[model samples]
Target: MEFDLKKSLEILDKTPTVLEAMLQGLSDEWIFNNEGDETWSPYDVIGHLIHGEKTDWIPRLEIILAQQGGSKFDPFDRFAQFKNSEGKTLHQLLEEFKILRKHNLEIVRNKKLTNLQYTLKGMHPSLEEVTLAQLLATWVVHDLNHIAQVARVMAKQYKHEVGPWFEYLGILK
Candidate 1:
């Protein structure tokens, strides 16, 4: 499907709403709660997502638009950036994400994709080039992927157990 910039902005706007709901009434302890060392607690995930939106995705979009090549861009390490950040609560991170997302949506909405062709250049890890259209489409997909992940995690965390219902129905011993 063709990338509709306006539609993408509408979809991206949902991220902050989801983040706000997921974080409502969450305490510091809950934010830090993790199933294991490998699992990211709710707080970690928010921090990572905020960093990804601001530092990685939005900046890359700007780079793609500017068409100024030759500067090396590093693949962002979300976890590392989150760990290094000094914030004490997820609220701050969420607010930052909300602001950046709004700014990015504005930029995307005002952009004229037709008659625009730009070459992105990079060779450090590997060389690659992409058009503006391709970049916008990729970004929309990226946002959707993260939004799905957030939804799945929230479902698992908030879903009520059905064991009692299953037992009453003779589906379990």
Candidate 2:
């Protein structure tokens, strides 16, 4: 499907609320539970999302608008959250994500970009040429991807407990 700014913004705007409803009031045990060494807890996922808020979406948008062909996007540090979220509580991380998202949305709304700007091209380190629309679309999907991941990771916590039910639950698989 083609990008629609209004619908995208609606999704963007609700992410924090969606997350809060899913996670709020949960204990640290629930929030930090992961299946194994290779997985991330909900806490870690929030931190990663926060890291993207600060470094990825809007910065890439600006680069695309200001210097379309001049510079490629810097490689994103996916694990920065491990260092950055040190000593922070899940509550604090959630608040930060909400605040940063609000600020980023304000900037995007203010720009009132035209369709031409959305069609404008930018260089990506790995993807080569990409349009602003693609970047924006990724922003929406990224939120969804992580939300699904949070669910998957949490669901795995009960993998063994579910027994025969696990066979029916594709999420646990």
Residue 107, model 2: lDDT of 96
Q: Which of the numbered candidates is closest to the native, going by highest TM-score?
A: 2
lDDT, candidate 2, 1-173, per-residue tens: 68999899999999998888889899877899987987789999999999999999999999999973575788899999999999999889999999999999999999999999999878888889899999999999999999999999888888899988988999998
Off by over 4 Å in 1: 27-30, 70-72, 118-127, 157-173
Candidate 2: which stretches are off by over 4 Å? none
Candidate 2 local lDDT, residue 41: 93
Question: 1-173 in candidate 1: lDDT tens per residue?
Answer: 65666776667778788778777677765566654567776677777766776676657666665656554456767576456446555777777778878887776667655544434433222445555556666666776776655555544443346644644533122
Clash pairs (backbone) in predicted model 1: none
> Per-residue lDDT for 62 in model 1?
66
lDDT of each: 0.63, 0.91
